[model samples]
Target: MRPDLLLHRWSSSSVVILLGFAELNFPFISSLHIHVELLRGFCSDNPRNQQYPSARIKALERKMQKLGEFKLPHFFNYPPYFTLQPVRDTREKQIQLWKELILDYCKSQKTFVIAIEEEFPLFTNHVIERSLTHEAKETFLSALVSEGRAEWMDKGHRRCLILWHRIQDWADILIQFAKDNGLEDGVVTIEEIRSGPESQGTELHGIDRTILNRALKLLEQKGKLVVFKGTSTDDEGVKFSI
Candidate 1:
């Protein structure tokens, strides 16, 4: 075999091996080069020189645009965001950004609940073909739970209750809602508070039942309301005496 041909074959194999390693998320990959000696042996010239920075930037911009209310930082598209940063400072920033993004997404979308095994739109970026690893998802969600902004619905952490608004805040809102509807000393069913015409066009509309129950319990403790049990568990009602 010709010496030049052997070199070409070796370089091609080397490039493919390095790319495979990268795809597999190997830690050692700083040795891959794009120079002629590397690509001239096997790969074409045009693709080596074409930088894809713009693709990443545009992909990130399109994602934020699609999210509508989830405004991402400029560094969101900087490639490294997809990886778990090893450095303490960088990892802290990354985690903080993820935390803020999750809360902002939940708040804007009125998403009170998130199941880890379910398809949550914020967990994946389709344009970039990037999705959060299960570990990453749990890590970010745990951070939110630590800060009291979220809670695990079960011990296994399979589901999460995202409280973009605190229970106290929600309770206050419910009290104000009741007052606005002239419901002081009036009775209202749980279903009515969730889906009735009076709740329509308000934040209370389609609220998660669990969160509503927590808010109601808070008000009940404060003597603002009395919950009455019914024949069916789903038919619980609240009588406001405020």
Candidate 2:
């Protein structure tokens, strides 16, 4: 150790020395000791951490982005993201956000069905390694069903089909599309529109059968498409009319 450097460093701050000395002085010493004792007591009982709030706020920000609402982030700032939400309003709002995000993501990706048992893109935050628990997924899907935008294709919500566009909207699209493709009074195989060249790359592509059936039923109720058994064809097909 260099004596000159040690002297220079020690002499750097007079205030630090004074403050240190003040802690030993009788009047200031008692106050400082009381404060230290209080702090130590508090720490021993329950530590006040600065990290807890910062981590909490960051998680809140992520959930708020899912909400896509104009309100401040703290409205939904809660600790239960790690624990599944249980309160009715909180769970409702949480489910609403999840539903909206799922639909929005699907609309962007043209994903018409969400397999509840499968890993969904928005459900996992790989950076955080957090995902919706199975129960959370079911709750959100149930919320969508209550709103008519999603359906449980099976009794078990192992597969929930999403419809960013409602079945009514799809029926309208079918009517317009039938007119566009000159099927106003014509017959086409269900498979042809579902996966064949004519439906390639269209909204009709990659659509779940249950969703298609719902849409078809919607149109049938409106007298647009008629379902009939095809004895000759392998697929019992449908015919459409304007």
Q: Estimate, for each residue in 1-242, the C-alpha lDDT of model 2 and write its tens digit.
A: 76433333332223223333333222223332332222232222233322234444345335544433333222122223323555666455555556676787787677777887787766665423457778877877788888998878888778877889898887776777678788989888777767777677678876667777788888888888898767754475779978
Cα RMSD to native, each candidate? 8.7, 15.7
Residue 36 error, candidate 1, Å: 27
lDDT of 2: 0.60
Whole-model Cα lDDT of every candidate shown, in order? 0.73, 0.60
The TM-score, computed over Cα atoms with residue i paired to residue i, of candidate 1 is 0.73
Task: Tell me which residue pairs clash in candidate 2.
Answer: none
Q: Write the per-residue lDDT of candidate 1 for residues 1-242, one digit (tens) a residue.
A: 97455554454435534443343243233322332234344433334333334454345345645566566543332234555767676567678878887888888888998899888887776654567788888988999999999999899999999999989999999999999999998999999999999999999999989999999999999999999999886688999989
Residue 179 accuracy (lDDT) in model 1: 98
lDDT leader: 1
